[model samples]
Target: MRIPSLKLLQGFEAAARHGNFSRAADELCLSQSAISHQVQQLEQQLGQPLFRRVGRGVELTVAGEVLQQSVRRALDNLQGGLGRIAGYMDPGLVVLVCPAALAQGWLQPRLAELRRALPQLSLLLSTDESARFVDEIDVDIVIADRPLQQPDVMERRWLRDGWLMAAAPELAQRLAALPPERQPSEAGLLCLEDGFTDARAGELFRAHLAGFRRVGIYDDARLLLDAALRGEGLACLPKLLAAEALADGRLQAVAGYPAVDGAQYWLARIQGQPRAAIVAEVYAWLARQTEEA
Candidate 1:
């Protein structure tokens, strides 16, 4: 018997999995007619009617069901084997996902250390605010606020802390001249807009600045820090990101106020999967770095 086309099998698998040609087409980025054609070709090659028409849709026949299971298992095994080989051959490719702010303020600065520590490793980083892991994309690690919901994933807490009110030294000095109650209102306030809802902001504003006015809302911590440095206003920022500034006397924490307990950062991986040497090394390094920072 002649070998059937792998592409045709893939099309059929997608259609069977979704139970809809339109959905399969959308996923494969092909026209519905094209997907239907491929399925037709696949059925022709197999010399069997794979699908039975039923009220605006199609259901898999008994042969089709058997073929679908075999195809799925074969494809999964093929992909898994390829991934294992790739992981062995190119162990350096570490795909990571993190929040944008964490990527910029925390990860970027220490990436050089990571590179030096794992010289053979290459980094591919992406930002996903919502926890969405693409299994096929080969993401080995993720630095996120919460654990991934996917089964068989393990999460390790890297940093569990909160936000503190910070202001430039000069701005602090100026605020010191005003009455304690009026200092926040008289001074500028730099707000981090990312991951904040209107209700959360309102609550935070009410708690932190009962009488203070919001001068600016910034999406980036770096920008907020810059504004604070220029004596713009006080900014509420993660202690991890603002640690250096706080230590350098460039920014001082507003004393006598309660700090907000933000979500912790987690390093995640597939539970049963053996960690690649480089991935293991990087994870350890990140843990140490966060601890020291």
Candidate 2:
């Protein structure tokens, strides 16, 4: 029997892990349809149905579950082997992966502190949200909104963030003066599209202020913040990301709106890989940063 390609197996593994094609595609940095097609090809080659559509998501069939277990094991073995070798090859080099907003709004500003804490360690930071430990690439650590649930990864909740609906001071003043029951028809809603920064923007808007019109969708927190600063629209943004703007009066919190619970940031490291002393030092420093945050 001909063996399926590694890409096909990888796609199948990601889909099975996420149980949703779109999420799997996000993790693997592939288009949703591409992941779907790859999984379909794998099923065709195996001559068995792997996934059953359940509403908008998917459920694994018995065969799919069996295949998933095996696929996970096989991929884990390969990743572990490569990680072990890579760990020893560059013991002082540490790689960290996280969303761009986190890197920009949080980590970048604190780089000097990290460098001072681990003066001997070399740091490489990747802002790609798709970067994870399971792939063949070298990623020693990750800071993500979601906890790393893979058995081979160790995670610590780095920080809990909150989001506030905010707008430019002028806009906030206008909205605040409106009658209690009057909706702010002059302002439009701004949100992130496929946002990884704080994945609850839409939910927050829907739960608290669904009457507002959605006028703009961006893929970056900075863009949303910029739009709000320009008086283009109101946006729900991480408190930390907008702290400077709010303080300087470029943006102001929407009157009477409470902060929404944002996703927790996790500091995670891959397990079973060689742990250098520098890695431990860096991890400790990161934990301290969270404590201070």
Best by lDDT: 2
Residues 150-181, model 2: lDDT tens digits:
77777889877777778888888888887424
RMSD of 1: 11.6
Give residue 47's error in model 2 in angstroms.
48
Worst 10 residues of 1 by lDDT: 194-203
lDDT of 2 at 180: 25
The C-alpha local distance difference test score for the whole of candidate 2 amounts to 0.78
**Model 2: residues >4 Å from true position, as ranges?**
1-92, 134-137, 178-183, 194-203, 247-249, 272-275
What's model 1's TM-score? 0.60
Cα RMSD for candidates in order: 11.6, 16.8
